[model samples]
Target: MAGARGAAALERDDPRRYGVNALETLLEGLVDYAGLFPPAALPMDDAVRNYAAYRVGERRGMLARFVLPVARLDEFVRAASRIDRGGDIGPWPLSVLAGPIDASVVAAFNREHGARWVIDSIEAKATTVGEVNAVAAAYGGLIVYVEIPVDADPAELVHAIGAAHLRAKIRTGGVTPEAFPAPAAVLRFLAECVQRQVPFKATAGLHHPLRGEYPLTYAPDAERGTMYGFLNVFLAATLLHAGTEPASLVELLEERDPAAIVADAHGISWRGLHASAAQVAQARSRFAGSFGSCSFEEPVQDLAALRLLPPRL
Candidate 1:
């Protein structure tokens, strides 16, 4: 009898063969937990419990971060006290939302928790260049992500984020039809980030594995809205970062057919062009970061249902 090796152990010697290796290459540690936000807005207690469970669950390989609001830091710590954790789970890495990137505050929290938590990133809303600069100045070392308004001119703001050596953030979609940015806008934001060499993370609304019209909420009568599939956005990003002409990117982002995506160790193809897993991984590491979602199960389950992820045991 032997313990199971994780996703990292599924690599291929050739690095060009498809299957588990390629899937791992594409999805290794992707989703970030934002269960406190709208639609599924789980309470601090419930969200913390879900995060702790997922960190040790079978789908843990797909988990990347826990998004906690700045205002709820106290609540999170208090709720986290009741969840029993083993040594194997490690410190819960967090992306604190709406907080000043003050190292001392984070230090105090870490000091109190005895290595149960570590905060290395902060997500702040910035609608202008000056605002972005203002937030970037507050933190000296932590990765500060400034969420830019997609409706405004993101070029200058994105440039500022890059110049300030900070990361960019976007609200990819939300609970309403209007919450989702248009394909052109998303493509614009991603292209600008690539042009400016700024890394970014997406929050809210993206839960499906492919682009399609899905219910906006857990409510039965919730109106369906077109949501950007994580695959469409990330794959388009890989191509954009690799210097592929982005004219087709608009269509790529708007693409819905799961059959349109063909992936292997060599690379993944949407339509006719290809982007290697290493190239995509580089884009993920250096440019596009993890996306925030309320349900960890939805995206993983969707990917599995689509045959993108290996079937459950």
Candidate 2:
């Protein structure tokens, strides 16, 4: 495919943009392998219909999942109620996005639908970690995921989230690649999550599959009144955690070679992403029996399949 030329182009680009502080030339060669495949983006929306439509459009790729963020439990219930009544869309898995303050909502949702709720810790109150942990423990069987800021001390977050039987996810924004976490740090976090047996997910600023510096855009949401792509957060984190070294990670980000990273197989080695299909199935089965089992779906299934889980089944 565009592997060779893409690699060369990446070498010419600035590796700093991809969040690696390593030898540029080495990073380029390492990233070349990632050029063989592509990355997928989840549909972004605040409206139920829009999210449903996004899921419908995501059937074409492996990473077409959907996440819904709510500020309150009432909002989540209202939205879930609407989705339940809106009729089935397809096979996409729908996760309810909530933060530390939304624990009551998560509890309420779990009570109503069990594992149908995915607790999200987006922009949460750090000071209330104990409260969040309590809620997470209360709903131990549900999919509890937390979003750690780029600057947040992941060690503590990981421990706190894990103790509560919740997964920890790293959150990012469109800052310079230099500001992104180190590959070693990302790997350590992933490894820790696996060791702790917690599954995590990423969100926002990951529109493209590969790593690269783009002219940051300011697409603000009218409702939330927030701008998008402020720091290229997703791309940087993907590069670091995509099962590669600092060099290759930087190369992919500099070149924006989504295809390369996906094909490398070794490059995108997230715990769930690279696990054997059987293993993934087992994980899903295990999750199904946990407090987070309501939204359990096979991780080995492509993103499209995962996204379609709630709607199709």
Candidate 3:
């Protein structure tokens, strides 16, 4: 849901930009801040502080999980305790990055910490179908997103993931041009997930809101690549799952024109078709889940530059 406070702020600043209200709803809790990851790989203290600030600020509504590796739960716990002000900032929900799931560490940490830190999700890599299934069964109630190989036939792994009732994960972009898969490959992955009724989340190289050529790293002279837009990926996924015009997907994923993607009070419109907020909400709830970014502010600032997040917000 869109935050009432944010809408009210926008209403006062420039009432006309309130259409951004609808756009804001489209991204509510849509990004899992991965400040622990590449590019803007801040230290645990810095990431924890930034997350705490965001959790209590205006854009808090847009904030999702604080992403960190499972191994550093203690580091986060220590850093967070000093800054969190005893729940004033957060009992932040987290999505742990791990390989070969053994959630006991996470479960034990949460149990002894007055539940101040809850590791409710795991994003793990899977090499074989059995590994995927084993992870699914091991996590019990914790939400598990299995990142499988998108290079070869992903059907069997996707099928197994779907059957086990775990969300699928996709690596949409990366540190190098070669790290990002072809647009068609991504589309195939999303289509298969949708076709299989399996929900998915995206990660990596999606710092910007729209797909365009961008730097692969934070270095001053970093190499550039064609990065997919978080907006394009999510919108394409939702529209595809809704059984909208199937052929439009390629263009949708590759669309660099932010103007081509618009949101009115009614819903999100791209090119020519529309997806009702209800439908997009459904997609967010069940089909296409959230993406991870190292800097939450980068995405929000991009939206602001596009006037999708006006001064009021």
Candidate 4:
């Protein structure tokens, strides 16, 4: 697979972006907008419009790159041009989903649109060490994350990723109950990544901030299923990075009660376990990165409802 290089340096989160002191360190650029994917599965124009709006929105600080397929770069350029006529809404960053690796396509897109747009990262799958090595070698100049299966041990694949100096990705949930990984499986993935000194990002089925039963989709009759919370995933990863025990990590991921969790200026705590604000910031910036979400509003709304966010945010 061919890939391009060049992602701007990661910027530290400004304190003013989110007023919630407790969550400010954990949530900066925590969401990568993936509106084009399933569940939401928005049309291209609508997705482009939504991302452009988010770039200038109040909670923009919480948002990260726009996620799109590499093949749709042309379509994105056209749509982005139409929506942001003054070029005021860009230079938009993107994390392109890769299919067959074509170096020229990605490189050409960056050459033409690098000023107003950037292909900062690429996300692809690698079920084996060889695949991980190939992806790391091909995308050496850019930030690359390899998605590995979590049904079994991911130690070798994760180790390969760490050795390649790249990152890992996990699929946390989907449209059905079966789509969500068991809490133990998620815990294992986090533990592996932490032990191997590998950072990871997650995608799919993480719209809400807390784990609970929710409608699978937007349809009126959409069946509901238990979904893992973004807070749960990140917090667990943060704790895992800080040397918290595995048993405690599993409880954090499986915890559903909003009252059982606490987020304040000092830190975030679940039950009696605690991770200080400095620890949260370090874990997020180093080991645990952002997750891809189909709907940005859902997360923001959910956090506001939990009073984890300021009223104006």
Where does model 4 exceed 4 Å of error?
A: 1-20, 85-90, 310-313
Model 3 agreement with the true structure over 1-313: per-residue lDDT tens digits:
2221122232212334334444655587788989989988899999999988887777777777889988898898889878845435335678898765457786777688735667777998887888987887678777889998787869999999989999899998779898898888888899999889998989998888899989899999999889999988888887887788557789988888888988866678998878876666667667877889998998998988887763433
Q: Residue by residue across 146-174, what tens digits does model 2's lDDT show?
A: 66653544666677777776667653323
TM-score, model 4 to reference: 0.91
Tens digit of per-residue lDDT, candidate 4, span 1-313: 0011123433333333233465666777888999999899998999999987776677866788899988888888888878843434336778998733755677778888888888878898998888887787677577788899999988898999899998999999988878888999999999999999898999998999898889988889999998999999998998888789887777778777778878877778888888877677678768888899999989998988987764433
TM-score of each candidate?
0.90, 0.49, 0.90, 0.91
The deviation in Å at residue 148 for candidate 3 is 1.1
For the record, the alpha-carbon RMSD of candidate 1 to the native fold, in angstroms, is 3.8
Q: lDDT for every model? A: 0.78, 0.36, 0.79, 0.81
Worst ten in a row by lDDT for model 1? 1-10
For model 4, the local distance difference test gives: 0.81
- lDDT for model 2, please: 0.36
Ordering by lDDT: 4, 3, 1, 2
Q: Model 3, stretches more than 4 Å misplaced? A: 1-21, 86-90, 310-313
Model 1 TM-score (2 dp): 0.90
Candidate 4, 189: how far from true, in Å? 0.3
